[model samples]
Target: MSAQTPEAPTVTTEERPAKERKVPRVVILGGGYVGFYTALRLRRRLGKREAAIVVVDPRSYMTYQPFLPEAAAGALEPRHVVVSHRRELKGVDTLTGRVTEIRHADRTVTITPTEGQPYDITYDHLVVALGSVARTLPIPGLAEQAIGFKQVEEAIALRNDVLNKLDTAASTWDPEARRRLLTFTFVGGGFAGIEAIAEVEDMARAAVGYYDSISPEDLRFVMIEGSARILPELGDEMGGYALEQLRKRNIEVHLSTFLSSCVDGHVVTSTGVEFDSATIVWTAGVKANPVLNSSDLPLDKMGRLNALPTLQVAHEDGTVVEGAWTAGDCAAVPDLANPGSYCSPSAQHAVRQARHLGDNLGRFLRSAEPTSYEHKHVGTVASLGLGKGVAQVYGIKLRGWPAWFMHRTYHMAQMPTFNRKVRIVLDWTLALLFRRELVALGRLHDPRADFRDASAAPRPKGAQKPADKAPQSEKVATPAP
Candidate 1:
């Protein structure tokens, strides 16, 4: 038995006019490797009271791009590869928008938001990690035809697009139409282009299961590269192995080929070749976001900000820009590991450099000495669908299933949350216990087509079944002589 007591009146303190927070607000632009890791480490090092961190970007999720191929191939779930900023990054304000300009002198930025009203945000310390945008060409009709491979949504869209193509080909009776629908062309032979082509091809092959008319041999997948070889980052031997594996899968690897035009569905190559395909994927390369060029900071030949070893923006005369720092693809920092080289634009470097930048920023704020950003380059690894892959680390080469397994293991550990990781592990475990499938649900986009004409046709009153009022076999027709 509990005694019920009367409640006392709540005491109100002499409301101190919301004392202004004394800590400086650290505004981070772009929620990528440099932006995410920068804020994440900053919060851990400085505590919430020392400074407030605000992360601004068009998306609140950080994409673990290495597993994108797996997601497309159904080896990993699409959601598992994306890390939620609001959920994982504590003590940070996440703003979803793109920054148009930076007023570095005033320590302020003019951001043109994607929605709502445009606004200006002021900050004490500014971190520019806007990263890069897709590098494109003046080829005709590309803007309307091509897609990028930077985000999770893009991967999922591509997967759906590929499966849809398979479905279109399967149900079509026209030979030319079926041939065109089954053709897929990918430009560039870098990590993105190769992995994307391989994974989508794998998924499309699986989708052929439900199609009695379409066979795996009917599909044609092509990879075009202007360079003499593919996987230029992986060096020669492993790159050769990658080419062989692609050839083994029946994917045409076109070297020293270029895209001249892609008007409508017709694609013309520099090697005097032409084809019509339902899909054309472009993963050629990337360029620094032009917004960085609008800033007053010193820029490199390619318009990337000339970043100091300390990850701070410096002038042509070697002086740090006040309260401004830059990292990732937007910044060209010196590569101490190799003399006379700039750091390559990569996730491996950007993440570690971002962590260091956060620490250096804190050290600078506390009047402590800052350290330079230096790192050793770990080698590259790539998957070739299913249990095929290639890897080169520390001058050692690994191939086949071993490399593929290593690739999955490495990225799984790197995949953001425990919940997502568990789901991915479950997906893989179930995959091992099931049979491979090539199933495409293309009609999901429009399931009303079959029933559309039923009511519109002249029908009897209260027609319960369509077959009831329909004419019977032989039509009971009699001819008079």
Candidate 2:
């Protein structure tokens, strides 16, 4: 004690207390829509060190989800859609961890990091920005075979898987095998499902030209929806036009139809039809993250936090949970604009709310009154395939390249950063110069040569090797666009 070791010195409770320090700490959860923008805006408004902003996310980057379909269709580069959380959030301390629970009673949150022991994070104020997850139903074989189109990795894997199917169809001479590989089904007629089906079908149709054997007609595209109509946002007129456009492409749109059962790669519909499909995409709907259920905050029917118009969370007693706030799809904030209708889960509302949430957080930090969040609905735009599309934006009906241009134009304007916008624009510009690509890069999944050796095993004079080996890119088939 007389001679303090220079190598390691002891710190007292005064230096670092079990309680929080004088720094005004703000803890924002999730790095998606609400989380990233909230952190970025807060950092901008709070000066250099007005408040200590900490962003906790399981991922280091915020994925701009709207561009996912384009990415899968090979229209946009995969990397451009993601905005780095650390790079964009300059002064905000970033922690890579999953928040297991938020103990509002103690003003503390427990986090489970990817590694190391779990730790507690204390915050003077908290922003719950945990985004929504794919809304899944208890459908048989769904969890095993069907892939969700919500995340980036899933989109990439789906693309590879789709291309893999085309290669399999091309390599095998068996009619049954070829039919199975070429048959693709999507469950959901929403914007995500429709766009995905359209783009994939278009891409496959284009690539079929490369294969002398395979024709575009060999590729089967089926869409099954439980609802009677598609693109609920565009209303009946545009919706009808969208359906007509898809039908014109030979896409089998089955309204009021869904997967009654899917065992292996075969799907049995409620209408008694059964078929084999190598690819099945589920983009039905979305729900709040289950992490919200772990928190003490009051939640709505779908497990979304009940947020006030001011963006603060309120208990049953109508009192704000002092430093707690929420926004985006996961928050059930009262819609002051409409009397009873709640906010729909869309990028449009989430983005606008994120800006407002950031402004509100800034106001609260400086003891200024926070602003209430309220925004009106803009229009909806959807791209069918190639230059074919349909959109009803602000009561204006558009189709063909006009709607397609509006789709790119609107999303480009809001595609996160100038850097990404440029890359996406460049992708589109190149598309103008060149034709749409439908080549399937299915071989990227496995790099091993043993399977190839096994498949190419020496055979008897008349006996044939079973066509069961994984697909390759070299067996490249002509695209179907």
Candidate 3:
């Protein structure tokens, strides 16, 4: 050995020490608007090498909820309103699962996958943007019978259901049966209820033209609201304008009314209105996801995550919880623009908050302090069926066609990817040129019918299993025989 001391330092490439890969893990517990948008922005802010981002949602796609009404009306394709998370989230990991529990102390979340066994995922930071669910009442038959207007599936199902009812009403001979089939009741007066009711009403009215016996008059569209006013987002004047517009279309508007019962499609209202309606669409309201209790995170009285203006999860004493972030309907983020108030649970605020959160998260990861979230309320725009709408944009009130145009424009501008935007526009164009798809794909409801048929199919000679049956009775002889 030329130098014995050199032998101690000899090291092969395979034996050399490897560099440690230390990427912070971020776990987001929802694939809704806020969750998806935040992940999008976060990936842009921090590349894969910077952070390992994971999004968990029960559904593989994110629904553009604003266009749900249009989807129900058949104005836009249901597929166009949904963004596939797996395809869109290239840099981030998407999990089709639900966060059953969050152990904040250990910074771990228990994930229940759509398939396979549940597992625990540890994270350096966690975002609780699970969003809200349709709030239900104690009223009878509401859960069993009534349908919702939330997901794209719901929209498509509702569309087919409404069209199917029209078909049934047209064919049915009984007056009571016809009445029940034709009646459509919508609960709640917010944008969801109003837009859904209006759009579906338009579709139903158009569908009536195809039925020789059915007419628009036969289709009863009734809206029931517990509040005294509807479309409150458009302010008092515009809200009143929306109400008047809906009334002009002969859509019954019952205000300050609450649903007492919906037992077997017989809707009873607090205002003494009771009727048998085959269709009861509930857009009543949304409550924070009850899953918040699964974690040690602090929550408000309404069950929303207590979040600071910076969109960080906060303690009961209003202290920011480290490594925890939240936004959207689930987070009660303090409103910087409005002192002593929190951000309203709305899409606009959700998007803005997601942007702020993404920025803050980037800064925080880079060892910088997070900034506060602040945004002035622009206004609201609402569509009351085709060619009718109301809006208060930048303090300027608009009504009718102008408002409708603005509504379409604003939403088109905010409808996520350019791919969706183009597809939606093309759908609108095609709708203008061709007759709408009034045909109901009712089989979608029981899509397993084919499977059932297959299972009921006769088996091969040897594969058939004989059924156990009682002795058959003797048949009577025919008169001719």
The number of the candidate with the highest lDDT is 3
Residues 1-481 of candidate 1: C-alpha lDDT, one tens digit per residue: 9999989865443332324446788999989888988998888889776788999998989988888877767777788788899998988999988888888888888777778887999999899999998999999988888888888877776777788887667655568888888899999999989988887887777777667778889899999999999999888888999999899989998899999988886889999899888788889999998898777668888989888899998887778887888899999899989978999998778888999999999998778988998999988888888888898877788999988887777767766668778887888888899965445455555679768866576768886765534355434532110
Query: Candidate 2: misplaced stretches above 4 Å?
Result: 1-21, 437-439, 443-481
Worst 10 residues of 2 by lDDT: 472-481
**How do the residues 267-311 of candidate 2 rate in per-residue lDDT, one tens digit apiece?**
989888899987888988889999888888888787998888888
User: Candidate 3 — which pairs collide?
Assistant: none
Residue-wise C-alpha lDDT for candidate 3, range 1-481, written one tens digit per residue: 5856555776674466544556899999999888899899999999787899999999999998889999999999999999999888888999899889988999999999888999999999998889999999899999998999889999999999999998777755568989998899999999999999999999898888887888788889999999999987777878888888899889999999999999999999999999999999999999999889888989999999998888899998988888999999999888888999988888889988988888899999988899999998888988888888888989999888999899899988988888999999999899879988888998998989998988895877887355543223312322110
lDDT of each: 0.84, 0.85, 0.89
Q: Pick by TM-score: which candidate is best?
A: 3
**Candidate 3 residue-wise lDDT at 469:** 31
Clashing residue pairs in candidate 1, if any? 206-437, 206-438, 207-438, 207-439
Query: Ranking by lDDT, best first?
Result: 3, 2, 1
Displacement of the residue 479 alpha carbon in candidate 1, Å: 36
Better of 1 and 3 by TM-score: 3
